[model samples]
Target: MESQHSSTTTARAARAPLVFVLAAAVCAAALGWTYWAFVQTTTGQFADESAWQEAGVAAPDTQLPFLRFLDTLPTISVVIAAAAILFVAVRRHRYGAAAIAVAVIVASNLTTQLLKNVVFDRPDRGVATLDFNSLPSGHTTLAASAAAAVFIIMTPRWRPFAAAVGGAYSVLAGVATYINLWHRPADVVAALLVVGIWTLIGGLIIMRTGNRWNDWQGFGTGWASSRGWLGLCWALGPGSLVLSAVLYFSVQAIGPAPVPGTATLPLFFWWGLAWIVGVGFTLSAAAGWLFADQARRTSARAVVP
Candidate 1:
């Protein structure tokens, strides 16, 4: 039994690096595809423009609250990430993990800015929209990276709950940017992918370097690590994808051709919102699963005397 457990742990640890690499590669590819599809193609431009235009139809009463949330988002994200990193470094004595998490946040945000301003360019695709490039939204990147930073510093037992809450906050931030006409749907999705890439890299480092505290018994060990939280994310992620597909096709079947600046049903806005929710929860669940699996492997190895 001991030998079998040891072999299992060895196999899992061996596979961990490959898994993280593949996941990060997927994120990078998705970021590239998002930019190409939404910023470089005519059809993509039309869809993006349609979604942005639809935001103008949002209920007037909701604008103030969203605006206020955006106003506080920067300060709130910075404070929360800073506090979490400090706790892990000072109290938990995981200085290396904390430093890696901070690097993830800063590097992800800086990458987004570079891609949006310097690396990418918006050409005249004959879509009557702004000519400036905003492929990876700075605000979305900031919010997602902050959430990811908190998630990284948490123990495996508490990670599921953290993932769900943080994912929801990131989704809300992305949706707010979309509804407020500050960014298109593609920009928000790209930002999420960018953070995801950095998070995966940072998480792999934290798992390897901070293995002492990374172990956990598994899900349901506590309220925070309960299966219920992970189940919620599982449900929300797929449900939002289905909802987005339904809204998109239904709108296409019923509505006329999309014309810039023309008043239309808010279905496009809802579709984009659903996409944001889906991406956020999906990434959240994936991250939780990855860290949990790594922690389990670490725990198994610790007992392999």
Candidate 2:
């Protein structure tokens, strides 16, 4: 039994890095596709621009909150990430895990800046917008990465709820950037993907290094690790995507053709918002599942002795 368990453990450990690498590859591919579709194509540019134009349709009373959130987003993100990292380092004494989490945060943000400022460029596809590139939004990157850092350092049992809350927070930050016209939909999505890639890489390392603390007995072990939280994430992730598809198609089927420089409706804005929610929750749910599975396998192997 011990030999069999050891063999299983070895097999799983070997496969774990491959899983994370594949996940990161998916995010990278998605990021590339987002840039190609939204930045390089005429129709894509039109849709993105229409969404930005419609942002002004938001009520004056409602705009202030989003604006304020954007204004203080950096400070809030820093404090939250710092507190979480400090807790993990001091209380948990998982110094390596904490350091890796911080590295994920910094690397994600740095990669975004590099992609936006140095690697990417917005060609004039006759979109009648700013020529400077903003495909991967800086604000969204900071928000998502910070939340991801916190999520990374959490115990396996606590990670499900943490993913949900962190995902919601990141979604709100992305939507705020969209509503305030700080970024287009693709920009926010790209930032989420970027952070996701780093999170996977960082999480794999942390799981390997801190395997003892990472073990868990699957979901419903506690309030924070309850299956209901993951269920909610699953529901919201796909539900929001369905909502976005329905809204977009329904409007196209019934409403008039969208005219430039005119806010016919906030269809694009709502559509963008839905996409943000969907992507954020989906990523969160995926992360929770990955970590939970890894932890459960670890727990199983430990019991064989």
After superposition, which runs of candidate 2 have C-alpha atoms over 4 Å from their true positions? 1-15, 249-258, 261-263
lDDT string for model 2 (107-226, tens) is: 999999999999988888877787888989999999999999999889887899999999999999998888888888889999999999999999989887786577675777678988
Lowest-scoring 10 consecutive residues by lDDT in candidate 2? Answer: 255-264
**Which residue pairs show backbone clashes in model 2?**
none
Per-residue error at 252 for model 2, in Å? Answer: 5.3
Per-residue lDDT value at 25 in model 2: 97
Give the CA lDDT, 0 to 100, for residue 76 in model 1. 90
Candidate 1 structure quality by residue, lDDT tens digits, 252-275: 678636585364567777788888
Q: Best by lDDT, which number?
A: 1
